[model samples]
Target: MSAHAINDRRHGQTTLAHFFFAFVRGPCKLLSSGAWGERCRLAKFGGECIHSDFHICEDAGRMGNHVASELPKSCDVENLWLCERASVVMAKFSVLLFLREQWTVLVVTGTNVGLGFEAAVHLAKLKPKRLLLTTRDEAKCKQAKQDVEQCSVTNNIEAWPLELGSFDSVRKFADRIESEGFPINAFIANASIATFTYAKTQDGWETTLQVNYLSTALLSILMLPHLIKSTTASDTARLVIVASDAHFRANKLKGVANWPSILGKLNDEEYCTASVMKNRYELSKLLQVMFVREPASRLPNPTPVSVTSINPGFCHSRLTRSVESNLVMKLMVHVGKALLARTTEMGSRALMHPAVEPSERDRHGRYMSCVEVAEESDYALSEEGKEISRRLWEETIEILAKIDPRVNQIISQHLLAR
Candidate 1:
């Protein structure tokens, strides 16, 4: 009769249900190899098991630890963990399905192809009030809009133009969204690039730094007012940023210690070489994590808009196609993909999971991996990381304020002051 006793009884029931479904529906299959390194594509798709979609692994590592502690006498541990990972993701999606409803409005970027497109399709199925998909190319955006239309009954999906490489374009897009007067329930900053080539945006910043970090920070800040307006007593708006696990591999940059002018060091031509480009994307993602974390910390408790970054893991996408100029790098990437890549569909689930799932609102400013809240890189959590995050936040606001005066107004009026 006690609360603890009742909870334990329910957990026992759920376990029995999972085992029964696993056995009767079909054996959980390991469709591919590399359980951890690559993540074996588990054969639990198409709802093969009824309860497969109901169980979300709160602690992503819990199942792996469980499998390790109680490995079957003659079983392959890696394959077993693969099954666990597959089940966890599938279960997580089902939870989303259960919570599905007509969302007020949601926006996704880089939807011409890959994860963004796939995520748009999944979100469309929810039949939101409006689903805006943006891409840099008009023709491709139109085609993507048509493709998404065919997959779902949501007729409100619209394709818009957005070029992250230019701050003007980013500001214009935000202007249009704000002018529309519709409260944005969720904004997914999913567009990004990874290339060995060095270049600068029209804003005179490194291409990766501008597109992946600067422009993204700008748009998120510009849109904060709308996101906050959308929040109410019953629901809070969400800002879901598609970051990456590669942030863990990010090399500490010399520029970060430069304080207010850190962007200057990154923009220096010498620092943008093909060699330094090896970790360019990773570094940008680290900056993004820091950017999101600082703002999340500043927002008042019971925050109106919840900001979170997600690591969809490595999936097959055009994000790095521009690196074709480097044969050796291309070959290395090819092998890495072949060995360990999740489908865009799987990756998209990670992208949309936090956006639609109400439970994830509490994870403001946290990093999500495999659909669960996970710790960020050691450097990102160190005292040094804190200092860099502080400087990055100030610099971002400064630069954005120069581009659009609205940035300062939004931060001062919408977000908590330092």
Candidate 2:
């Protein structure tokens, strides 16, 4: 490291910027290439025309050894297509770096419309090698694929069918993904459903619990193995779980410390059959947060994967369609959409930030409240809270195992028996 970088670290402000440059420099060196002239690429493509954006010219070989001699210092050679892979392989060695080559394969659920669709549009601009757009309806997934591919000249965009309401269906979808042998870079758990009434899915769980949290948890576990296939040692595949700020509103978790019994208590037949699920959605969000926070500890040390939860905030999308069914509720949601809620596109920024950027290692198992890492609910802050999270994680694994023993096999292979 340079003395300037060491000194910058002491002060903190210049740390990431200095590290970023140094990180990129190491890989360019590996490619045995020198920086190019500012307009070198454009000069080849469009006859000496100049553009400020960094890009590569077709003929480095034609430039001969003069590549080093005719270079402009201001141009970033790191941005060239020539060094793309090397730079990507090395840039992530440091948590401070976010620069990466285009992801080879990425997955997004619930992409038919809403924040998932918005996030898909933004991701398309990055030009991932392949994009997996999933939804409950095959027709919707098809439309979403068209909508996403239209945003950029991306390579391959595929549509997959997923129904989160049934564990059996989730297991089948996950099994198909794992068996397909496609290298996955990131999995965006964006499929979620909200309900005002207490209803049970085919899996015999409350609708909100099954769809919003359990299905996401199961899909993430199944996808963990694929994420472990990152090409380089410095890199880790990302899991971006979209949650909501309503987590704080799950007052039922306040003062509860025993995690194993809590799910049972919440799932008691009498409780579901007799009660009106007023705060079920909020409770489900809280459970998702807990799952995100617990995965790191369960995974092997220096974890080969990074997990994070994102709150898109109170956004207006198809998510509001349920509330829209009631006249008064629809008016209130409409007002929220107009006056306070973020538009679907704007809210997708929450996923965009983590999806494209390499987050700080400290952020693993943390809640990303929008672009910032914000404090979680007080119910999640204590030592006992950690125990609760662990217990919930175990219960989730145990219960899901009864549904599919392969869940145990995957856990053992990736996180547990290692």
Candidate 3:
């Protein structure tokens, strides 16, 4: 049979048995060519095609040698067109197979750099159907997309600019996604801001709290409806907050027993105090965990969404660059991190693992370190903490409403629609 005739017959069978038989027979035709040169060219095409199709075909060796035997050495299949056609066919088959099986979506924040970037890279390999990455900088988003593209070409991933500090930006971003009709299966509130000096967002809120906590809260609220709508019985939706060990330190320093009230009044002295500076970043992370835990605990019976918080451990990334830059501070930070510091890839494992791994029994609302579920501080798990988180949620909604009424209305409508 002609190669074309065999390919036509094999088109209907995407199963492994048929694919291997057809692939081998197609290339084995060239084996009859006595010329050594012709045989060599055929072998090249067979090898290249097999390499490209490895992910699609389950049995590696079965299809490989079959293609090698048929190709003639004289007929070099090095033409880009042939290569492109092979890739497209493989991709189409792979995608169809993937779609037939259950799939999930993951939304990763601050994917442009550091821990967020590392997490996105790892998650892509797990084969989520869709991965959405958000960053405040468009240029950074483009770079992130490029980085992911290099790693796993089959995964469908997208990047968008999302400035968490601005209510306007967050609302606009959410609106765009809603209008486009994208579903969210999981969300990671991983973006955060910290500085040795203080700064305010465009909306006049403190930069650290605004970016690290408020904006993330707003985005989650905005996206909650889609998350709920997209969830299925076969799958459990999740919200993973990338929190920190600094949370424990924050609880110790501030007599501030509550989460929201801690943000109530920050005098210059409180803001600049040595303890405050060191713990402010940690406090923001703690608030995030508490904030997620509050709503997560309140879902109706048989909740559709499960929430958890995790600390990626100390990593050598841009987040810690400030401490690494100064001589004395760098030494101190290095010494501290060495005891527990993980590389970026290692640090991101916990974050990525939680998103992909199935939930453990009775593991919701727990804190995670090194991907193993751990306990949050007693203060964070107390009734006072829950109350404080609830109050903080209310206060946050009020503040955002004042900043952008449209966002408040949109979120309210989303909740109501649910």
Please tell me which predicted candidate would have the highest TM-score against the true structure.
1
Better of 1 and 2 by lDDT: 1
Q: Between 1 and 2, whose TM-score is larger? A: 1
RMSD, model 1, all Cα superposed?
A: 10.6
Q: Candidate 3 — what's its lDDT? A: 0.61
- The better-scoring model by lDDT among 2 and 3 is 2
Ranking by TM-score: 1, 2, 3
lDDT of 3 by residue, 264-324 (tens): 5442445546656666687788788787665565555466666778877667577867545
Cα lDDT of candidate 1 equals 0.72
Off by over 4 Å in 2: 1-100, 153-155, 254-260, 273-276, 416-418
Rank by lDDT, descending?
A: 1, 2, 3
- Could you give me the TM-score of model 1 versus the true structure? 0.79
Worst 10 residues of 2 by lDDT: 31-40
* Tens digit of per-residue lDDT, candidate 2, span 59-132: 23333234534445554432444333221110112222213444457789999899899788767765667778
Winner by lDDT between candidate 3 and candidate 1:
1
- Candidate 3, superposed: residue stretches over 4 Å from native: 1-102, 252-261, 266-274, 382-384, 404-418
Across 1-418, the per-residue lDDT of candidate 1 in tens digits comes to 2111111232222122322232222122222211111122333342222222123232345454544444333334444343443333332233333343454688999998999998898788767779999999789889999999998756889999999999989988988987888889889999999876788776788888899999999999988888998887767889999898677667776656654477777778986776788789888998999999988988888899999998776678888798866798789879867766656676677777778666546788888765567777767888988898888888788888999999888888877877
